[model samples]
Target: MALTVHSRFHPIHTDLAVVTLTGDVDISTAARLRDDLAALLGDGARHLVLDLGDVSFMDSSGLSVLAGVFPLLRESGALALAAVNPRIREVLRTTGLTRLFPIYTSVDTAITVLRAGDDAPS
Candidate 1:
């Protein structure tokens, strides 16, 4: 499983979109991720769960793509990361981005957490 990027649709109890990062996400693939995120947003998919368990490597470029996407999703309050790799997690932690996004151990947990948020009185 080299680092690659692919997306899948996950129709859970609520609207769920799963984007899985497979291969290395460096400068080479950063744009692809960005495009994917933008496409999802354009398609009216506010709820996005990025599954990063298959990613073997990532760099600033990859991080930038995520940073860009987070705000877009936040505008609608629907986005999360699921099963993020430890290496990527470490990078995010070191950069203090862990607090910027909601991360969960799995997509199921993410959905549960998001659903809870939806149920909470604003």
Candidate 2:
């Protein structure tokens, strides 16, 4: 199935964006994902929290997109993953990405961490 992305900026933290993706993140959709996320980053979204609760599958292209954006976000803020499924988490773990981004139990928890201001990771 085609990927569906739902992105929204937090009401209180305007620069923090919560993006949720559903469906596979493969060659077909990876470019779109990258462009959409790059747009958010360019639009002043320094902090990004990805709600992976609904994401079913991902490939290297997807991982590349996630890894590629980390540097930009790191310059000012950081990225967080929320509600990651076991299979996807395993992929992240196998690739040692668990060290790169913090994973939270929910979108709210991730938002809370990001909203903590400078205390949040960059």
Candidate 3:
């Protein structure tokens, strides 16, 4: 089955952008995610919260896109992942990426942290 990724962007506060993702993020959909995120950053988004609650899967390609964007986001802003499923969380943990990205239980919590300027890696 072909997996389709869907992204929805919402502006929170003044500088935070929330991108909600649904469906699997594999080779076929990683590019779309990257483009969507790049567009948000291009639009002057200084803080980003990726709500991955509906994302059922994410492959190495997806992880690559995220890893590549981390430094870019940090150069002028912050990025956080919210509601990541257990499978995806394990991937991050196993790859030691858990240290690079802040993971939250919900979008609201992520937004709150970013808004408070406490998004620095812990």
Candidate 4:
């Protein structure tokens, strides 16, 4: 199945883009996913939350796509994952990537927590 990627800003935090992915993310779809994700950051997303509840499978290419964005994001912002399944979680664990990202149980929770950090008095 083709990967379906969609992005929307949080209602309370316009700079945070909540990107939702459905279907498989493999070699065939990794490039397209990369472009879509880059577009989100380029369009001024200071923070990103990826909702992966509906994405059933992901391969190394997909992991590569996600890993590729980390540096650019750290220079200006952050990235989080939501609703990751066991299979993908294992992939991340095995690759030692789980330490690099904060995974939440839901998109809403991720938004709330990330937003709270920004809202803190500096």
lDDT of 2 by residue, 1-122 (tens): 68998899888789999999988899899999999999998888999999989889999999999999988888779899999999999999999998999999999999887778656465
Number of clashes in every candidate structure?
5, 0, 0, 0
Candidate lDDT (C-alpha), each: 0.79, 0.91, 0.82, 0.91
Off by over 4 Å in 4: none
On TM-score, the candidate that comes out on top is: 4
* Ranking of candidates on TM-score, top first: 4, 2, 1, 3
The TM-scores, one per candidate, come to 0.88, 0.94, 0.87, 0.95
- Which residue pairs show collisions in model 3? none
lDDT of 1 at 86: 86
State candidate 4's TM-score: 0.95
- True-vs-predicted CA distance for residue 82, candidate 2, Å: 0.6
What TM-score does candidate 3 get on C-alpha atoms? Answer: 0.87
Candidate 4, overall lDDT?
0.91
Cα lDDT tens digits for candidate 3, 11-90: 33756788888788889988888898888788777778888898898899999988988999777678899999998999
Model 3 residue 98 lDDT score:
91
Model 3: CA > 4 A from native = 1-12, 118-122
